[model samples]
Target: MYTNSVLQTDYPWTKTPLVASAPMLNIAMAPLAVSVSAAGGLGFLAGGFDVSALESNLEEAVHLIKQSSAPIQETYASTAVLPIGVGFLNWGADLPKSIAAIEKYRPCAAWLFGPRSIPDDLRPWVEQVRAVTEGKTKIWVQVGTVAEAVAVAEALNPDVLVVQGADAGGHGLAQSASVITLVPEVKDVLTTRQVKNDIPLLAAGGIVDGRGMAASLALGASGVAMGTRFLASSEAKIARGYQDEVLRVSDGGSNTSRSKVYDRARGILSWPVQYDGRGVINKSYIDSAEGGMSDEENRALYKEELKKGDLGWGPNGRLTTYAGTGVGLVKTKLPAGEIITNMIQEAKAILQQLKA
Candidate 1:
């Protein structure tokens, strides 16, 4: 009967790591999930955006889990118990398609992000997953603001609520509060409302190292979710040049901005209106307006940039590099497990120093 910092005495996540990899749109695939889970933290295979081959990805998640070097391989069988987590975008996910895949595989958790509807679609989706999962799957939602958190909490009980700040890489809330401000604000709202249970809060954005994780814990979060940090991981499916840029721009987080310049350049016309994409600025950024470049301009830029293929870095890099303010901390492309393990060790060291 020893008290372990990583073990939860609450309703969800009995035992977990201090860090979980944030689910990126097309990048949070099977390999990354299995690797992070095997390393003792939670990881989710992205359930939306490029999900036409979801079944194959789910199958691969199982295969990787079974093949993992960790002893968790035995605990997580090749059954429908869902050894790994899968996430779907609330704004644009094909619910029935996502549900069908989840029903077939039955991951341990389902993450819903980039909200478009709640109380109606969210409630039904949660109920359906519960009915099929026998209430075994944990429901996790990512909200950009305190209001969103309170609204979701009132609608249906969730296992985890992610408070993502504005400094985060990739698409997030239009005008978001920082993690320091947002997580506490959301927690206080939930507490004051006197919800049935004190939902767990996981802080995200600009959390690149153990110091960030430790700080989040001190600020009253159950854990921290890292997106930009993991983008540099060997398992993450991103262009090598993008990873290089992540390391190159460590101290200059201000260089990263929120804009649809890259999205338009790539011909992505319809991202959710309430959200915006964040990443390192490229050629498209300078000439682009606040609303983004015109289709004709972006098309011309895309055609020119596409010719570079893999060498998409430096001053003129035009590819969509979804990242956060912590882009500079990403130094190397290590394996997913190594990243988690090192982060845990670093957290322990930082916490010990604070205690002393």
Candidate 2:
């Protein structure tokens, strides 16, 4: 078989276009997931926030998937095994709720992000879910670096691996390796370790189109997971204003800063020592404190900004706008399915042209 680069190998995954959207709270992640799956890709409903929201989103996502499948529509039936997944913040919010959710939903896959390694307790959680789902469900863990990925892979024994680069939008590894630089390195590491599980390696952060998809796969990634690009889609749950900001921002996007400002104000208890989130630089959030203000001060400023409706100050503004470096590439909001389909088609074209 011909290969472009990165010593391409046939893995368990069929080398398809895979896009995973960040599960936003209150907003429906299911519709977005279903839309992407309907377009012949995968979708994951985010579930790590308030316990209520998590439960609600899971139930609603299942309901939507079932209802949308009514009448044996060819469209729905055609994509029945679209590889839908669900994700949760590993070190944020209530882990119990997330655990219970996996058992209840039994999604095709479960993704966990944050923390360098999967805690001992999480092993049981993973095992329980795997057992409850009768081993049909796969487990995916997201990490920032090659070392972190290896550590988690060894500890968790997840069915798949997701290496999220620093450019990934939302809360990710602070100041870590870029995805372009890390994918092949991680791939080499996995191969060296004598692990032949054929785990699908997913490249995240700053991937938007066929060019990016081809680049990542060529670099030893089995697939690509995109968040920001999908968030701008019509099926996404974000407000129009939020999506507009995402498109307006540049690729670098004013040096995205990660901090605990928003989580504290929202009263969402995240691990103080473990992780922070990256969001766009909002004027009001910057005004709350001098450059050196304490995290608490920033939280107060976030709260104050929440009170003022003007300046577009709110969660969409004061809170971090989770986006990847590819934000610059996102120009318009299209349906999630169209975006996924186009990227896959474009990638195939690029690869075919390269073969010729």
Candidate 3:
């Protein structure tokens, strides 16, 4: 039986980061999130866009969960069911609409990101969701530094603290602490601050597999949060070319830098200055960074990249290849359910051997 307490919740425990993936967007692959939950990991629906999409995904997830339960029942023999959660990029998505959707669907939790203060301007919104959820909904805030983690933990006491490293793909703090160094430090702080032990600690950024999961547990994290790995999975929404790039690119291939070039082009204006995005280095990106190109030229370049394919879709260099350092470990995209099962099995294998 899965011992993860969050699994006991009626809601989903989001198996992977729910954004920018190819398979996840597939309605057929939607069962993957529920599969992760059945395996004792939470699966999150990516709700970074708007209310309608959020509602659609939530409804779809619920449908999939119901749809997948027969197989789970056969396998678990009356065990508690797995939970499914939803993710919203606080920096880009609309909070109210997302919150409303959560209130209506009532997911297991809400994962929020963007470099800003924890217990941020969204506290009331979070509280409102909690009220609607009757305390069923949790808040998993992603942070890059011990200070930020500590701050957020102290203020909101979110259900989970996702400690993201600088190596994490997507948007993250411009210069932040590495996950290896920060997890233990945050664990100590949680102790000194007298936070509840059951409050889970999740380590993100560059985590790829069972080895990474083992490492996170050793570092005092209850579990690991993976984005890049899922992005490469068959259920994600990325282009085939993009998935190939993630696999072919070495772990060091994530040397991709962070910047707001894409944010500007995408028209998401409210992101804080402390953070930037990581993406593949490309010509449009290079041209955007140079400042030599006129606005017309830059826009044209951005459009050109988009036309080239999904690889160049975000902004100039800002195309949405949000992968972490773990991309190197990824050899191919698999079903999200298979990925979770394999990760746990491999970690358990290694951990059992270590006890010997």
**The best candidate in terms of TM-score:** 1
- lDDT (10s digit) by residue, model 1, range 1-356: 11234224221232344567888878889888877777777888887754577889999988887788554475555334755678877666777777788788888888888656785457777888888878667788888998989988888788788889998998888788889999888888899998735577888998888888877877778888888988888899877777778777756466788876767777775667778888787777766854455667866876887778767565567776778888877888888888888877787798888789
Candidate 1 vs 2: which has more TM-score:
1
Task: Give the lowest summed-lDDT range of ten residues in model 3.
Answer: 16-25
Best by lDDT: 1
**Residue 48's lDDT in candidate 2:** 60
**Model 1 clashing-pair count:** 4
The estimated TM-scores of all candidates read 0.92, 0.84, 0.83
Off by over 4 Å in 1: 1-17, 78-80, 119-121, 290-293
In model 3, which runs have C-alpha deviations exceeding 4 angstroms? 1-32, 70-82, 115-120, 253-255, 265-267, 288-296, 310-318
- Show how many residue pairs clash in every candidate, following the order shown: 4, 1, 27
